[model samples]
Target chain A: MIPLSWYLILAAGLFCIGLFVVLTKKSAIGILIGIELMLNAVNINLAAFWHYYTQLNPSQTPLNGMVFLAIVFIVAAAETAVGLALIISAYRRRNTSVAGEMDLLKG
Target chain B: MTAMQIIFLIVAAVTLGGALMIATSRRMMHTVLWLVLTLMGVAVLFALLQANFFSVVQVLVYIGAIAILILFGVMLTRRSMVDAGESLVHKNWWVVAVVIALLFAAIVISIQPWGAAHTPLVELMEFKEPISDLGEALVDPAAYLIPFEVSSVLLLAVMVAAIYIAVDRKGGKS
Candidate 1:
């Protein structure tokens, strides 16, 4: 049986890597990729905690964590859809997809 | 170490490595490929956690839907699939690295003190019809009904908005 901390540590590492990508990637799509990674890391944490919680409280319904994770998944899908749409719209206008190059309002 | 522990370690390493590659890979197409690998690894982790439904959903929604969407975005936005002759990272990425290191250390330290952190997972409980339970909870008036309906509405709105935003106007510049 794996310790809960191991999962937590893995989630932390994954989250940090995702953060790094989000902070540094020059492409807007790359940032979206990073956000997906971060969201997956969160899903892992939620699943891990839920697993442990079920162990301690067997009588309670074990749907909460899974429910929350479902919501996160829904949100991730919407985010990707809207984000890519905006990116495509912006790309059509700017003729470039680089995040740093899309500064029209730079004063 | 137990087999489960070993498996977890390998999956974690692969997942994190894929994430690192996504961050550092110079080509956008390669980055999207790495994202698929990383997302698959996460789905594996979900299976390891005994959430079979989520494991399937992770693959279906993440790899199948979101990853393909990202790939399309990459292909559509760039003139060529290969992204070259441009800096992939910010000039001051090292600063961000340092900050992330501190953040990771803080997370580790904070997690270490929890009494339940070291508890090993017990044997799996006999969950009869987990999928049905999840379905019932989603539609039940008392549980997750509102949130589920709200999310459905949100998805619908997002779909409409995305179509509006991405469609080309007849008079607008292409």
Candidate 2:
């Protein structure tokens, strides 16, 4: 049987990977993907806690995690839409989507 | 091992693998394909967690809407959809070192057990009814009405901002 600790560890690993990607990648959409991955890690952690916590105790509703996760997911979607729009606009002006090339603000 | 656990493991593996591919891939189309797989895996994970409504929404909004928009951007901007993605980070190794340190810190914090705040888990008669409850909570006078409306407004603002920028690009306005 997979323990709750195992899920948490996996979630941690995924979160680290997402952070690394976000920090390293130059593409705006790529960073957005990393952000989504990080959000997924958080959602997984929440769901794992909900599952195990409910397993341990038998008096609380099991759907709290689901509800919270649903909200988070929606927020993530909204963030992605806005982020992509920015990316597209940037690409239109620069003719390239490379992150390092976007140095208009650099001194 | 319980079936749920087994299924969860499979979904996690798929999601992680897809995410890695998304990060490392150079081609734009390949990234979009990997994203689709990643989103699908996340949807399955949500289902396994009994968030059926969320699973549907994940598929509908993310896999359907956002992924398509990404591809659309790729096609509309570039002549071909297979440009080699540029590297953004400097050649210094210190960034990797810092990332590793931060990741270790996060893991340590997550694993620490200060005190166990216990709560009971009731056997819900309708695991699915919470979907309706959530819908009601979003609009109810005593619940999350403000947040719900605010989120919608935020989405609308994003939409307007997106259109403005896209059109401004054509008009040569910075």
Candidate 3:
């Protein structure tokens, strides 16, 4: 069994990279991809902890992490669907998918 | 090195490298491909942690569904399928590097003590199938029934909203 910390570190790395992409990407869909990456890191953490914690307490391994992870999967799929749909809608109106160009609500 | 350790290194490298490519790639197709690669790495990582169900979900949901959705979005929105110029916002590399370095350092330092008390694994894993437990938990009154029902409702609402927002009934041809 690998040390739990290694998984944690890897998740952290994935998250930071995602954050960088989110902060820097000009396209709205690119930002969405970054968010997916961050969510993936979170799922990794949840599963890794579940792995270790359940090992220590085999009698009482709560299914919350796994449940939450499954829920996240569903939510991510829905969000991606709606988000890209919105982006396409926005593209039709504004003729651009660039984040900076999406200033309709700007004061 | 142990087999697990070796697999870990390979998965982590692939994931991180793919993420880097996703961030830096100028073309949208490249970005989507890199995202797929990165998601696959994450799926392998889930398998490594013994969560075979999530690993499968990772592949099905992230790689199979989301990556294709992103590719379609990229293809549909852009006038040219190939976006030749820089698509990312011009960034100050030094500032981004400093932030990433700080974040990485904080995470590493915070987790350093956990390595000291690393628990050795039991020879045999007790629970083989977490998928069944998760299924039971979704419907079990004593468990997470509300959240499960709520997620379904949310999905329904999102589907409706996507149709509502995507369809141009008022402006364009129906």
Candidate 4:
């Protein structure tokens, strides 16, 4: 039987890697990828917790975790769409996809 | 170690390795490919956790829609497929690494004291059709209906917003 902490630790590592990519990557698309990874890590945490919670409380029907995760999926999809649109728009105007180079408002 | 534990370790390693590759891959196309690999590994983890619906959705939504969108973003943004001669990482990336390390340690320490953290999963019989329960819960008035409807509206708004933002506005100055 796999303990709950294993899932938590895996999520922590995934989230940290996402954070590293978000902070260090120079491309805006790379940052978007990091955000996706972080969201996935959060999804894993939610599912794992829900699994354990249902296990501990077998008498109750608690599907809230799955519902919440589904909502997150919606959010992730919406975010990716809007985010890539914004990136494309920025690239069109600024003529670059590098994050540091988009400093139009850096007066 | 047990077979389940061994499988978990292999999946975790593959997932983490793919994520690491996404961060380090030089070409935008290669990064997107790595993202696909990482997302697939995550989907497999979802299956291992017995969240089969999520595993399927992860593949359909994430890999099917999102990864392709990112690939299009890569293609539309760059004239060349490869990001040659460009520095991929920020100059102060070590600072970010130290901060992430501290964050990871903090998370591990915080999770250590939870009594539930050590507990193993219950038997499959205990679940009794969790997918159906999830479907019902989403539409149940007493449960997640509002959030579900709101997410639908959010998706509609996102579609409109994406189209508006990405449309090439010709002959417009400033």
Candidate 5:
């Protein structure tokens, strides 16, 4: 059987990768993708803790691991929609989608 | 190595490698593709964690739906794929260094408990009843009724918003 540490390590690694992507990627939608990755890493941690929680307290049943992840998923969808809408609107104004090219706010 | 260990390792590799490519890839479309692979690996890992319901939902909602919409958005907005670099700013190596540092700290903190002791795999298999239990809880007044209803409303709102944005205006030069 695989140990729980392995899952935690994986979550941490994925989280860091997502952070890197969000910081490095130039496109608006690409940053959204990075946010999704970070969300997935959070979900992984939640699921892992759910397993551990259940084992430690067998009588109570699992409380809120998957539930938390589900909520995060919904929020991610909402964020993507709003983000893409903003991106589309921005793109309509500026003829390019490159992240670095957007400097309209800079006076 | 055991089958479980091997499976975990493979999923880990895919998730991490796909994430790396997603971050570094120059092409926007290619980045989305890598994200899909990464999501699939994450779903597999969820299954390994014995969260079968979560695993299936991850595949259905994330892979089947959100990924498609994202790709659609990319296709609709971005210009034709150009090999020429289009990035606004060069990546800061310091960010990666910080991430690595944080990762190492997290691993160190997590190792104390995770490495100390472990329950056998059979015990974990028995707790698999959470799937059905979770379903029952979702509708139970004492359980997750509020959050469940809220999520449904949230999803509905997202659907309406996406449709409106996707169809409201078109042919704008960008």
Candidate 6:
């Protein structure tokens, strides 16, 4: 059997990579990509924890972990939609996608 | 060394490597492609964990739907951002690297209890069909009915907001 820690470690690594991407990338879409990666990491963690804990109390319904992940998936999707819409609107107003150049509301 | 470990390693490599490429790729389209690959690996990982339903959801919602939306966002959004700078901004790479490294260490250290390698894996004894139960639970007033309804409302609100923001007006370009 594969150890649950492996999944956790992988998720953590992926999360760090997402953080790096979000911090270093200049484009709004790239930041969105990083957010997606981070969300994936969270799902991995939730699934791993669920799988690990349900072993102890197999009688209880294992719906909670999956439900949490499912809800997160839905929220992440909605967040992406709104984020992309905002990014596109900003692009329309500014004519550029560079993160540094978006200084209209900075003041 | 086992089949499961090998599969996990492969998925991890694909996911992490694709994420790295997405971070460093200069072109937006390439980043999207890498994102797709990473998402696919995550789906496979979900399947390996025996959450086949969520694996399907990951493919359908993430790869099929969300990816296309991201592509549309990229295509529709900057028509000509030529000097948009490098995807991996060199000026802040060192700081970001340090931060990510510290964050990764913290997470790994914190997740030790639930996922230590010594913990043995046991088969799920009950609940033949978790997917059906999930569906039932969504509507079951004693379970997650409130969250289910709330999420639907949230999705509706988000859809309306997205449409509102993405639409163009007669003289709103400025």
Top candidate (DockQ): 1
Ranking by lDDT: 1, 4, 6, 3, 5, 2
> Model-by-model lDDT, in order?
0.89, 0.70, 0.82, 0.88, 0.78, 0.84
**Which is superior by lDDT, 3 or 5?**
3
lDDT by residue (tens digit), candidate 4, B1-174:
678889889999999999999878878889999999999999998998888888999999999999999999988987522444667778888898898999999999999998878887645574555777778877899988999889999999999999998888874552
Per-residue lDDT of A18-74 in model 2, one digit per residue for the tens?
777777766666677778788878887787677666666456645456656767776
Model 3, span B37-113: residue lDDT tens = 99999999888877888888888878888899899999888773244355465467558868888988998887777
CA lDDT, candidate 5, residue B82: 48
Two-chain DockQ for model 5: 0.53
Give me candidate 5's TM-score against the actual structure.
0.85
Candidate 2 local distance difference test against the native: 0.70
TM-score of each: 0.95, 0.81, 0.92, 0.93, 0.85, 0.92
DockQ of each: 0.79, 0.40, 0.63, 0.71, 0.53, 0.70
- Candidate 5's residue-wise lDDT over A47-101, tens digit each? 8877777767777777587688778888987888777776766666665556666
DockQ of candidate 3, scored on C-alphas against the true complex (2 decimals): 0.63
**Candidate 6 residue-wise lDDT, A14-87, digit = tens:** 89999888888878888899999999999998988888878767788789998899899999999999999888
Off by over 4 Å in 6: B83-90, B110-117, B122-127, B171-174
In candidate 1 the C-alpha lDDT for residue B113 amounts to 89
Give fnat, all candidates.
0.87, 0.34, 0.66, 0.83, 0.49, 0.76
Which window of ten consecutive residues has the lowest lDDT sum in model 1 chain B? B78-87
Best first by TM-score, ranked: 1, 4, 6, 3, 5, 2
Give me the TM-scores of chain B across the candidates. 0.93, 0.77, 0.87, 0.89, 0.76, 0.87
Q: Give model 1's docking category.
A: medium
Q: Which pairs of residues have clashing backbones in candidate 5? A: A100-B88
Candidate with the larger DockQ of 2 and 5? 5
Instruction: List the candidates ranked by DockQ, beginning with the highest.
Output: 1, 4, 6, 3, 5, 2
